[model samples]
Target: MNYELRLYLDQLTAKSASIELNSTYARAIYIVEGSIAIKNGVSTRLTLSQNSALSIPESFSLGGGSADAIMLRWELVNEVDNSNKIQASQSTLLLAAKMALGDLSQYIIRCDRVDFPPEGEALTHRHLGGGIRCLLFGSIQIHTLGNIHTHQPLSAWFEAGPDAVYAATDKTLASAFARVMILPRGLIGGKTSIEYVNSEDKNKPKSQRYQIFIDELIQH
Candidate 1:
């Protein structure tokens, strides 16, 4: 079935505060700033810090931190109408894409961080699945569709799988970005999503480093 995939930035004032979620869709929550405790009906509570993330179907509200807390939420919607359901106090939609999502059992939902040191670059390559990326720090340039686009911290962009692209980070300082991708189930626990365009480029040195936060089977 076709589905709409979305990414949002949510902010909470303090403890006892709450945010609504789509219980029918699978979700990936990443703590962007401050801290929050996750509590559910069964008393299963989990605390997440900066850069931490998890995959869950239910959201019981988030609160508790010295100041306002922020989170990046990825939601998978089975219907187009439910894709834009917004809560008055929830989050701002960063981006959305409609996906055919061929076989629910053959895909996995994942959240990961790609960090690049000063002067780092990701060579021309393509991914196996489509996803969106939101900058975490520093600046980056993405080359695709015969054009180059620059993005700052908090800025977001979408990458359609199979399109060749190259990325370059800030030259004077370090850069990092957090991204969520819908990948093949075969990629579970492994990092084989990127495919360099040139066969000879495969032997070239790489400057980017990866750290995965969550990788789980996608649920319908």
Candidate 2:
């Protein structure tokens, strides 16, 4: 797969401190808390409140608000080709729209609300499909691919193409909650769309999958 996941967080505490975000990949910003003002130096200032999201275009420098705000930013590695050089069928467009809406249909698209108790950890495992997660509260550390990264509240992280083994543990004595969305890279209409790989000592369990309705997300 040519796509990669880039996740980062922005915290604005002081009234004079602003975050400069510039990315070559298409990106999206989700406001985890407080309010943020987004300006691209060309458009009018856009204000986003808690639980709101905004899509940003490639090659843009946007300045975010300067006071007590936490936001999760997500960007994909490859810029999607939007040229109409090759025509696509309606079915193909429908599928693409479904994928964008987080509806994988026959493929796997699961939303999991994961809670890790104090000092809790998950068995080393890998998902055939990649996913993105945002911490709702507390913090968690992820150990994967010879590296360890800790994510704090309102922070977002994601894995790339299949075979990325990782384990997660809470960073504090308090429990941590996260909302995760997992999706398969390629859709398999008839066969199972996702798989799970456990460590050698762990049992091979069936893959647990869930569906996310687009209407439900829109209402929230």
* Clash counts for all predictions: 0, 0
Candidate 2, residue 14: the lDDT equals: 33
lDDT of 1 by residue, 1-220 (tens): 8887788887776674554444745678788888877777666777888889988866565665555678888887775556335564666888888877787879898899999999999999999998889999999999998999999988899898889999999999899999988899999986679999999999999999998988888776
Error of 2 at 160 (Å): 3.5
In order, candidate lDDTs are 0.83, 0.48
Supply candidate 1's per-residue lDDT for 211: 87
- TM-score, predicted candidate 2 vs. hidden true structure: 0.45
Per-model C-alpha RMSD = 1.8, 11.3
In the range 1-220, model 2's lDDT, one tens digit per residue, is: 3443444556554353334444533345566677677667677577777666665634443343554676565544433644211122100111111123233232333333455656666555655455577767766777778888887765556654354445455545554433333344354232333343544535543222222221111110
Off by over 4 Å in 2: 1-4, 11-25, 38-46, 58-67, 77-115, 119-124, 130-137, 141-158, 164-168, 171-194, 198-220
Top candidate on lDDT is 1
Estimate TM-scores for all models: 0.93, 0.45
